[model samples]
Target: MKIPAANRSFFLFLFPLFFVFHGFVRNARFIRVTDCLVLTGAYFLAALILYLLFYALLRNSINAALVASFVMAFYLFFGFIHDPLRKHSIFLHRYSILLPVFLGLTVLLTLYLRKKAPFTRLSLYLNLLFLLSILYDGATLTWQSLQSRSPRFSTVAVFSEGQPACDTCAKPDIYLLVFDEYTGSRTLRDVYHYDNHGLDSFLEAQGFHIQGKSRSNYWFTSFSMASMLNMSYLNGISHPQALTSDDYTNVWEPLRKSEVVNSLIAKGYDIVNLSPFDLPGHPSTVSQPFIATNTKLITYHTLADYLERDFGYVLQRFIPRASKLGNVYKTNETVISRTIQASSLHPARPRFIYMHVALPHSPFLFDSSLHRRSPEATNVDFRLKDYLDYLPYTNLQAKQLITAIKGNSGGKAVILFMSDHGVRAWHDVSDFSYFFNNQNAVYFPDRGYSCLYDSISNVNQFRVVFNKLFRSNLPLLRDSTIFLQDSE
Candidate 1:
């Protein structure tokens, strides 16, 4: 009885465990063990199949198992580490457990089914699968992009009908400013109508005509920005998954060459980007370069990137917000400060400055000093109440940025202000039901007067801006598939 070679992929058994455990222990959530078992069995079986796949490729049974295990781990980590099931909106107890488990099982079955596994044959098969998956992903993404609907808004008002003469003749240097989670005016008016007046008035004073019904298409920044920047209407997107062979991959379509940035550049405007989420290697960093007309974009990468490049993440698990607290800063306020710098550069061309700010996005820490709590488990005194309570300073910082931008633009700039998405299912929209529901943007903190999601979503945000900026009589995208105003 000879002992078998060490199958390196044996660790693939842990792939299912990692995903199952990920949901079980994220940010503190509760799940049943039945769900756990289902996941475990599903993933284990999947690993078995992938192991055989290795058997065919590598004459060494051990090496074959290792190859399969590597693939299993890659998917498990991609799904678990990045998209913590508990934190995701789609995380259903039974499905979250069963689904990932099923994926693991599928891969295992694939590995097991390969005939009389020889290293050469098995490697060829694995290589083919990898190449096909990549090509399919690319082609499908391209088609979806081309098929996506173009955005235009529905409105009674004709903004393009009138334009007061300003020999400043600087092609309406568009400054599409999106303040992450900066809920829109229409949202406040409909939901928290009473409290919304202040915001409404401010926009009016700034010459911004808030579309009382302006809605967004998608909830997340990635989808929403794609639609807004391209000036197209996107209803929603289906993310790709590959648990079963039929379960194909889906992705966001890339913007066409005719979109805003290119159109602007073609019409002679320079583009500069500023995304607060810019932490080294952020998709935006790689992506913005493609869509951007100029490379002057200022981005912070990610909080971790900021922490590593600047200070140490002493508060890695439990951390502090980088808000100002009268000097002696731990992590300097990099996000806001960078935006101000970007704004100054805008005046140089018929410039298009897109600032994706994320201070208000999350880790919900708005403090001048260190975060309210630490990992010590002691009463860190940092109450969770309004962790983003530093909105005033946030607002002030915004004000300073705007002031600086205005000065540089010579006081003439069309600033399209909006939020990428909503507060993370907590804080202001802290109601468990409201936060967790499909609703992303809500009228909370008392709806501030009017709520947006119940009335309209991000589906139609860019239409109003394009109409306002380009001055189209048919300003609002009237053809939106969503029958606005009577979806009731």
Candidate 2:
């Protein structure tokens, strides 16, 4: 069927709108729907401006719409085209070679459209195609949202109301400080050849028990943390195969509504989320570092993102704020300050503060002197030496943070300091077992450290805590590590 000329120009706007919606739908699990609002409005405005400019030049609405569609497609899909070509051929990756090719194609398309009659049939096909694509994504997003609202698992079911609790037990302020990518002391000594005994001794002197052979139950943060907080292995809550799936809603749902957190809340404990990501009811105190909350698929894969990944050190010299490395520095600084403030709060109810500090992870931003390293010095190579130098800075910060917490809480707080996983960036290493070796330490005011063992994985950390502190007889799962295919 042939469409009327009056509606042919509408496809130009529909294509751009579809582009934005498609990207949002792909990343909806990580980001919120409202996060894409500004970007959608911007794409529509750009499409309108391009259509008006092309119509003024071509003197035909259908011809102008076709040209605008071609431009929008090229602009939005540049990164997708560049990434694969760059991996295979150097010449094909260069903007000097690719940009001119796109320009020439656009020019030839314009000349062809000028000679031919207005293609109303092509416009109708595109309009139907884009409309169908948009509806599909919208439906998928709505179904996922409804599923999330009614999750398969509930907090009430996880922590039964009949579970035992100690009414007379002293509920000291509990703190779980998770340091991302801090390898175990053994890994530091054998792999990196750096002795982390100083930090261990400091923790021991301050009434902390350091687990020498600690390992994470899972390699990825979401899986490890979800298992840790829920006090169950991945197979218990959801399918073990879901660990490899791209969609993390199953893992993240259990994490957000953790049984440990819910049980604490039920016992009159305040929850403080000072982490990089949100928890059940509380949002993150600081903004997430590299990826902003409003990030979408197209925004993350733009030409600028490729440049930042490849040539960020050089660009940082010119525009320091533009670098994501700089953002990591700012985020770590804010997390430290805010954590200290949260510790000092003397609330009547005992508090459970979850402070996840992303340090010694990536974007090695600090030196041994506690000064921000120069942009040129920021190592993307993930070298062992770079990691060793950065570890001392983290150690210093950890010491200061622990001391402040002890002082503010009057030596009456239970602190659990551990890492999500070990150093995962060492690509050349052969033996991958060290990837699970993470740092684990705990400080209990009552000096009850007998229940803790040497090789306790993250999945059993909270179980021991609950049994010791609240008399909650949660059975300790076997300490074992399930290595996933991908670390991230």
Best prediction by lDDT: 2
**143-163 in candidate 1: lDDT tens per residue?**
645764532221132222243
Q: Model 1 scores what on Cα lDDT?
A: 0.43
Model 2 Cα shift for residue 123 (angstroms): 1.8
lDDT of 2 by residue, 90-132 (tens): 6877988888888899889888888888888888888888889
Full-model lDDT, candidate 2 = 0.78
Clashes of 2: 0
Q: Tell me the number of clashing residue pairs for each predicted model.
A: 59, 0
Model 1 lDDT at residue 85: 44
Off by over 4 Å in 1: 1-169, 185-214, 235-251, 254-258, 276-283, 286-335, 346-348, 367-390, 424-475, 479-488
Q: To one decimal, what is the Cα RMSD in angstroms of model 2 from the true structure?
A: 4.2
Using TM-score as the measure, the top candidate is: 2
